[model samples]
Target: MTARHRFDPTILREYDIRGVVGITLCEADAHAIGRSFATVVLREGGRRIVVGCDGRLSSPMLEKALVAGLTASGADVVRIGLGPTPMLYYAEASATDIDAGIQITGSHNPRDHNGFKFVLHGHPFFGAAIQNLGVMAAAGDWEEGAGTCEDRPVLAAYVNRLLEGLAGVDPARLAALRIGWDAGNGAAGPALERLTARLPGEHHLLFTDVDGHFPNHHPDPTIEANLADLKALVAREKLDFGVAFDGDADRIGAVDAGGRVIWGDQLIAIFAEDILRRQPGATIVADVKASRTLFDAIARQGGHPVMGSSGHSLVKAKMKEIDAGLGGEMSGHVFFADDYYGFDDGLYAAVRLMAATVRLDRTLAQLRDAMPETFSTPELRFPVDRARKFAAVGEVHARLAKAGAQVVDIDGVRVTTPDGWWLLRASNTQDMLTARAESDTREGLERLIGEIDAQLALSGLSRA
Candidate 1:
């Protein structure tokens, strides 16, 4: 029998397979992904694969179908059951027998959305690899045979491993600190609950129940609005700091005791300072969208700062290539290869954040306060025709080049001016154009935004 399938074009993205569940994605797509991915694994002379799912309402259904497909394609499936995306990454990275892994999750997307993130042989499986799944499925190119599936709950082990991140911190310092955590009612809730119970200090938790409805707020931590509950909790408790997780617990958001949100780049700066102190002169990679302040901070700390593209997968690959001890995206995906596995784990990051603060002998708020101040707009995203997004960025890049403007063309056009820097990039995951500007002063920041606006206007588009 011949088996063939085709995914909605939108679902086969650069980094993962994702879409609105009933609309662009469905059980059939999940099955196809599993079958096709298994073929890829089998062809690579591997058969063991790990699978997991998030707290999304549809995740169980998708996971079942995916497992059936994997087994049908002759791939042994080790089901890790429900958990955050990083737990799946952990299973794949730590297990000596597993050849690849997949996590059914929506990540930071809305409740109605769902997706799959893949790791093959401990490395991110994305970009061309993701697209190739579609190609193979459409062509009915899949292996065949009856394989086996088994359940292995690793949530406790994963939580214990996260505790290791705080291994070297002084117990007295940790016991004295007060912290708040918000799981955003996502897949990370259970893990967060278990983790805090074992940690020292006064711990306050919010929305740690795995509610797929997300009754409190959206799960995305990158949006300031999503962190309102966490901010409020931090302010009310007068805690040392607060940390929040996205839908799948791969990205992290933080707020100081003053209830001030710490943007991803700023978090990177703090982490870099701590990492550099231990690994002196180690390489730290930050996505290009990060503030120049972060880059400068790393360099000032005697670390090598390398700017890479924005996606987590891309950043991870870049980090591996350059042997970077730490890497992060401005969107809150932080990776630490210094003392732990080189993967983005929000729960792990929270632990490390505390360790960093204690080891530095500073309060989280104090560390945040010491950072150089700068004004910047949050990442602005507006829709553009999928085909037009890249072209528009290219047009802006050419114009900036002809004008003799200093630009970093790594992932897009980030034009540097005496006042500040403005970035215009086409988002790889969506049909959207993203822009950001930063400067040392409010006036300079406004001017940088104007430059972005002008470039967009020239491209026959305007910021909304």
Candidate 2:
């Protein structure tokens, strides 16, 4: 008889399957996810599912086990091998035979962490769907069938698609621009090495090997500390710009020639204007935390600007609902629907950034300089018990409203004041409370920060 493995309930999440290395998850659990997910896919009449993984050491092992489970469920699996989360999404959207896709990635989480990003029938398979999958697995309801796995290298094809759009972009001046890249030794390195060969620019690289350890810096570029090496590279080489990627390369960050970090909203503004000029009156979406400047700019360019919740799956769902041309978050996830599938792709975003810079005949900093300035806080994270985080946000929201503050509660409570706006929300992926404040000036920004501090103090949380 086959051995029966106990299912750990926590590995199944609202958005995708995720957990630690051994305690909460393992190869057996991954096998269960694969099999169970495959059964779910097949039951939905899915014929093909695309699978891929990030550079986490456990990913390949888990992926192999997952494919086994899928095959056992009598489904055909197309392994996209190693690539970014977007590439997996791209394959699913582009392939007529594919009905679903699963990315075995931990995203920008710590080194030992891993997870899955699932798509079902061209829509995000998340929330209650993910939770229900867990119950089915524990019940051992996964179907048994003659499932087989086929290796499909979609990276080359994916790159070709991105390059075709950027093919006409000339690099005569970019050849003089020095560039620096930090893959964080994540999955994007191998692909980026090839992309750089096509560009005419002086380049420097760090952590190009796909090491799951992530020794030099964390793969998350949203955090300021992670960009230290990239900043140093820019200053040392006097490079025009420096770019960094998350573990899966679906998100990105950049430093200007002056070594200043450019937030996601600013990047979106740069891209939104360019996209609108080509396809006027297109719609752009951004998370609530993005600056008001971005929303205003999109409108100025004859585009509609919409704000929504802050999760990868949530944003993508909103993108399709509104048929948006572009969408992004402060955390660096950017989705494009103008020329490609409505999935976030950091590599693709970079290509467009390069083309925009080239086509406008403006340097990275020069284009950035043309945008209006506003004061904003970097995202601030404070530890809160998982159970209490949401409640705290609720309490804070209620109090802010009773106090007669102008409040918006899409993701959390974002209070709009005469001076500026402040946002307080519970992080979807971690046991933390996230906050950001922005205004027209330094004093206004500080007032917004102080408001957040007062609310946290009341909740028995601290900035420290």
Candidate 3:
């Protein structure tokens, strides 16, 4: 007999499940996921699933339907209300009673998109687990029992935890701090509003309201143009610092008081150094796309630095594997296990940055200046047919042997040379090819970029 209700497996991804709402993922799919997840959790002996959602117009409805499925499958539900992805992660990691959680979000995806992030037993639940959920949902094999669903202000408690972790930053030091927060019209907008109220300073806000339409700009700060408002506000207001968040506020980007971008690598580098101070000889992991400056800084601070593949799920998995005190991606997902539960939270990261700034008693510009200097290219994106990007990378990999380049293929290919390193990789979340090059000198960086360009051209792709 055919399966009772089969959820599509194509949408099940390596990290989280995402697709264009109504097209690939609808209320029916959400309900199936809830039932599937409930079955899995029950089989694994879990009784509850912490549920949350972002500001996307589709999120609330999805959460409701998913909860219905969860209750049908004999799993209790704890609703944390609407907030950033990290708040969902925080609430899951904060309490020992909750065994699994799911955040209904689209993250940095376009407005037409929505998805779910799942965590089971304090680890990111993905890959095969997601596929299995689909199978169970389709089979209609989920169990049935009486289940409880509760509503509570988990956001306030989450904010309090962040404040406690950043208690070192005295209110006096913050008085002179004029800050700008670009919420990017995502789940973090509301949370940022509440968190900023506690700090002692004049805080400028942008897109702090929850608008799934994202009226101001796309919610992703990783794209440089999306950061325009924050940069301009900093420049015009002479602000002490500026912070921006991706759709869910799990990833963070910063601008110095001078309006210069403090990229993910640099921001995490600062946090890594502070973490090492607290626990010497600690292990800290950063994705391969991260800058060498971060690795060197971590080593200098007597910490073990690990380079791993890129992807939020991959990094989070590695963090648990190594018992790493911290881990981050160049895309701005920074996980802190030092004093917190070791998940990326833009608000928490911002607080720690504030503390770091105050502890050093230096302006944000001065702190950024304390790091080593190097010439680097911004992450450049070029469209590649989804089917061809991987093949192109494989083609380039095959050619690497004849070229005699130090090709490191952890994420894609990172050709290291005496003067610099250049990377060419396919975006895990999109049908695009991305490249970045860094060097101690500008000439070296140029040469590296030329090599990547030539390689892409040779692979039958054109640079954007």
lDDT of 2 by residue, 369-456 (tens): 8877888888888888888999999999889889898888999998899888889998876788889998999999998898899998
Counting clashing residue pairs in each candidate, in order, gives 0, 1, 3
lDDT of 3 at 121: 86
lDDT of each: 0.92, 0.86, 0.87
Instruction: Mark the regions of model 2 whose C-alpha exceeds 4 Å error after superposition.
Output: 1-9, 171-177
TM-score of each: 0.99, 0.94, 0.93
TM-score of predicted structure 1: 0.99
Name every residue pair that clashes in candidate 1: none
Cα lDDT over the full model 1: 0.92
lDDT (tens digit, per residue) of candidate 1 on 111-165 = 9999999999888999999999999999999999899999998999999999999
What's the residue-level lDDT of 281 in candidate 3? 94
Better by lDDT, candidate 2 or 1: 1
Task: Locate the minimum summed-lDDT window of 10 residues in model 1.
Answer: 230-239
Q: Top model by TM-score, which number?
A: 1
As a whole number from 0 to 100, the lDDT of residue 415 in candidate 3 is 81
Q: Assess the local accuracy of residue 61 in candidate 3 as a C-alpha lDDT between 0 and 100.
A: 90
lDDT by residue for model 3 (1-464), tens = 42356655557877889988888889999988888888889998889889999999999899999999899888999999899988898888888889899999999999989999998888888778887887777677778777889975798888888787666667788676889999988899878888889877789999898899999999887788899999999999988999999899999999998878888898888888777776899999998888988999999889999998888888888998989998998999988887788778888988888887777677779879999999999888989997898899988888996778788888888888987898888877677898999999999998988989899889888897
